[model samples]
Target: MVAFMRRRTAAALLSITGLLVLALSNPAGEWWTALQQPYQSEDLIKCAYDKCIPEGDDWFMAHLNQTIHPFLTPQSNLSAKDFLWWKKLQRDPNDLAAFKRVVDKVFQLFPEGKGFMDSGSQRCRSCSVVGNSGNLLASHNGALIDFSDCVFRMNGAPTKGYEEHVGKKTTFHIMYPESAVDLTDNRTHLMLVPFKTRDLQWLISAFTTGSIKFTYLPVKAKINANKDLVRILNPQFIKYVYEVWLRNSGGYPSTGFLGLMLAIHICDEVNVFGFGADQNGNWRHYWEELKDKTLRTGLHSGTEEYRLIQKLAAKGKINFFPGH
Candidate 1:
C-alpha cells in the first residue's frame, strides 16, 4: 500500500511540473511581458501594426477611476501645499497664497468629467512619441509617423520644412513655457508640462488675456492653440510618474520622459521615434546643425532614461525606431 501511494504522488508531481513547463513555454508566460502588445518580429526594430497594451482596457480604466480620478477630475481643488509636496517648488515667502490661487485656477482649466479616452470610448489607440533627435533629420519617416492614431511632438520640432522626415500631423504638442510654440494646426491639442505654478499661470494668461509674459525664462505672450483644447498636466500625476514609473531617476523628470509616461496611460499602443543620440554619438536636434558635446538633458538623467526606453522596447511595451 505504501509503495502504491509513493508511485501515485510521484506521478502527480510529474504531471503538474509538465503542465507548468508548458504554460511557461507558451507565448503568454514569463517569456513575454504582460505589458507588451502581441507582435511578431524577427528584428530588433518591432512593428506594432495592430498591437495594443492590454492594460489600456477596462482593467486599467477601473484602476484609474479608483485611484487617479481625484487628481484628474476638474472640479477638484489643488492647494499650494499639494504643489510643493509633489514638485520641488521654491516659492517666494510672500507668494504662497498667490501660488495656491494659480493652482486652483489651473485645476479649473482642466476639462471636467472623465477623460475622452476612457474605457468605453478608447479603442486600439496607436501613439507616436516624436522627439527632436537629429537621427530623424534625413530618415523620411513622415508618412510612417503620421499613420499612427495619434502623434505627440515635444518642444518646437516644426514640420513645415521637414515634413518628409517628421510628419506635420500633431495630435498633441507637449511643452512648457520656455519651449512653447504657436500651434498652426487648429486640430492639435496644446498639452502643458507645467514644471512650476508660474508655468500654469503663464498658460492661463497666454490663452486668456496674455497678462503673464515673463516667467523664470522668457515665454511666448500668446499661443495660436485653441483655448478649448488646452490640457494641463496634473502635479500629482507628475509626482506619480517620477516616483512610481521612473523610480525617481533624477532630481526631477525630464519633459521627454514625462511625455512618454503620459502616452503609456492614454495610448493602447505606443511607437517611439526621434529619441536618443544620433549615429555620431552627438546630442543634437533634427532642425539644427549645432551639436552639444555634453548631451545636456537638464536636471534629469538622459542616459538612464534612454536605457529605460530601450528596455521598454525589448519588453515590447513600445516599438522604438532608432531613426537613422
Candidate 2:
C-alpha cells in the first residue's frame, strides 16, 4: 500500500509539472514580438495593390514596408496588425502574387459588394462576422450582426431562436456536405470551402440536376457553378493563404479572418465580433452554450486552429464577444 501511494504521488507531481509548463508556454511571453517597419508604412503596404504607384517594380517593394514594428492594438488599428502578422509569413513572389489574385477574384463573386469602389455611393461596411458560439444562446446579438448588408456564418448556426442573437438575415452561409447533420436551419446559403478534389466533384454532381442552385467560388476556374457569378481563382490563392497567411503567419487566422480579409480587400469597413474565445481563454465553447461551457463532443472542440484563434483574440486586435 505504501508503494502504491508513492507511485500515485509521483504521477500527480508529474501532472502538475506538465500543466505549469503548458500554461507558461500557452500565452508564452516570447510571442510579444515587435515589427521591423513603422505602422503607417505597413498599412500602406497592406493596401498596396490600390495604394501603390501604377505598375512598377517598386510595387513588390511595398511588401518590404510590411513588418511587425507596431503589433496588435484595438479594433480601430487592426488592419495594420493584420498586415504586420501577414508580413511575418515569408511569402515568395509567386505565392504573394497568387494570394493577391484570390483577393481579386473574390471581387467578382460579389460585384454588388465591389461597386463601393467606383460609385462611392454606398458599401457594406462594419460587418459583424459571427461565429457559432454557445455563449450566444440567450445573449441575443444576432439581430445586431445580421442587420449588416452582408452576413457570413458557418457551422451549425441554429438561426431559429438565435435570430436575434446575430440577426435573421444571414446573407451567406458557408458550409460543407455534412451540413444538415448539425442543428442547421434552412435560411443560410451554403458556401463550401472544399477540402478535397472529391468534394469539388460532389458539388458538380449535385449542381448539374439543380440540387444546389447557389453560386460556387472555387480557387480553380473549372469548379465554379455559375461561370458568371462563379468567380474562379487560381488554386495558388488558396495555396498561398494556406501556406503563408494561415500556416507561416504566427498561426491560423480564423475562417472569419480569411473571409474578413477577403471582405476588406473588396468591401470598405469591416467590424468583427463573436470570434476567437470563450468567456475564459478555453477557446472551445459554442454559440449554443455560455462562455464557461465545456462544449459537447465535436471536432471543432479540439482543434489547434481554434486555439490559435483564442491567442489572437487575447492579443486584443479583434473583438471577441464572449456572451454573444
Candidate 3:
C-alpha cells in the first residue's frame, strides 16, 4: 500500500507539471499568425518566392511577366507593332482578333452562369474599370465605363443609384461577402473576396436570396448546399497570397491587387482604374460621398501600399489613378 501511494503521488505530480507547461505555452501560434498576416495573390503562385515592394515597378514587372507568360497563347505575345498598338489602345481591343485573345484568356477563367456571357461574348472591347470614386461624378465616364464585356466593382459601390458618379452598368461586384452585402444595394453586381473560410456560407445565403446572384471566388470555396452559385478560383493561385505576397505587402494584399493579379493571370492585357488613395491618404470608395474628406480609419488599408502602386502605374506596367 505504501508503494502504491508513492506511485500515485508521482503520477499526480507529473500530470500537474504537464498541465502547467501546456498552460504557459501556445500551440496555436503557428496557424494563428498565418491567418492574421497580410497576403498577396502572386505570393501564393508557383513562382511566388520573391517579396513585395513598398515602392517600385521592377518587382511588379517580374511578377506580372512570370504570372502572365504561362497563360498567354502564342498569338497574343505582342510583337513590337502590337505592343505599340496596345499602348495606343489603352488595353481596349478595337480589333476582333485582339478581343478574342483577351476573352479566351480572361473570361474563360470566370465560371459560366446563365448571364455570365455578356452581349459581346467573344470580344472584350473598351473595358472601363470604374473605380468606386466620387470623382466619376460630372467626370462624364458614362459612355466610357459601359463598354466593357464585364464590369467590376468593389466595396459597397452604388451604380444604379449614383449612375453619374458610380456608373450604371455593374457586371461584376468584386468584394468580400461582408463588404458586398453590407455596402451594396440590390442591383449592383457582386464580386466576392473569400478571406475567411466561412464567409462562403454567407455568400451562398446572399445568392439564394435571389435579389442579386453572386460568383464567389478562388481563394476560398463554398461547400454548402448552394455551392453551385459560386465560381471558385484555383488554390494554386491562392497560395500566391501566403507564400509570396503577405510578407512583401507588409501584411495583406489589397483587393485591387488580388483582382489585378487575377487579371494578369487570366487576361491578355489589363487596365486598372481608381486604385490607391487620393493625394492625401484617405480611405474612400466610389460610392462614398465624404464631407470630412480627412483621412478616416477604415478597412481599405492603402496607407503603406500607395507608393508601390504608384511606381507600378508610372512604369506603364499598370494603370492606376492619381498619376505623378
The per-model lDDT (C-alpha) reads 0.68, 0.40, 0.43
lDDT tens digits, residue span 54-92, model 2: 223342233222222111111112243343344343332
Error of 2 at 60 (Å): 15
Evaluate residue 99 in candidate 2 and report its C-alpha lDDT on the 0 to 100 scale. 38
The TM-score measured for candidate 2 stands at 0.46
lDDT score at residue 112, model 2, on the 0-100 scale: 21
lDDT of 3 by residue, 1-324 (tens): 224224433643664465446556747444323222322333321111122111245565455434323122223333444333332312332454444454354334333333332212232222345555444555544423443334566655665655533445654556665454333234444455544323434454453443323334332232122222334332234335423543344334566655555554443323456665544555566555566776543433365445655655565544444421
Off by over 4 Å in 1: 1-51, 54-66, 69-73, 76-82, 87-100, 107-110, 120-122
RMSD for each of the candidates: 14.1, 19.6, 25.9
For model 2, what is the error of residue 122's alpha carbon versus the real structure, in angstroms, after optimal superposition?
5.8
Ranking by lDDT: 1, 3, 2
lDDT of 1 by residue, 183-277 (tens): 98787888887667678778878877898778876789988887767777777777766666567787777777778877877776677888888
Q: Candidate 3: TM-score?
A: 0.49
